[model samples]
Target: MGDFAEAVRERVRRAREAVAAAHEAGDVYAVAEAREELDDALRMARDLGVDPGAGPEDEHEDPR
Candidate 1:
């Protein structure tokens, strides 16, 4: 992956972690914030020629 893709990956990873933590803590606001961040990250990934698939594995493994 290129530098920007790698940076996006890190953002995605952090967003995922934030979502998980927010869920575990029962923080609705945090969850919403994290989801928005994740969604933005996914969109950015797609714009950057990455496939935002059904799951993270698929996203990274997309042939195109």
Candidate 2:
């Protein structure tokens, strides 16, 4: 993966973590906002033709 892809991947990872944190904290509004950010990151990755390796379809795949 190129630098752009790596950066986007990092963004997606951070966004995902944020969403999880918001959910854990029981912050409804924060969860919604974080979800939106994650959605945007996914869309951006798709548009850039970057395989984020972190999507619904990859949920069951081994991290390694």
Provide TM-scores for the models: 0.75, 0.82
lDDT of 1: 0.72
Q: Per-residue lDDT for 1-64 in model 2, tens only?
A: 6888999999999988887788788888988898899889989999989987755425843112
Model 2 ranges with Cα > 4 A deviation: 55-64
Q: State the C-alpha lDDT per candidate.
A: 0.72, 0.80
- Find the candidate with the highest lDDT and give its number: 2
> Following a full C-alpha superposition, what root-mean-square deviation does model 2 have from the true structure?
4.6
Instruction: Report the Cα lDDT for residue 15, model 1.
Output: 78
Name the weakest run of 10 consecutive residues (lDDT summed) in model 2.
Answer: 55-64
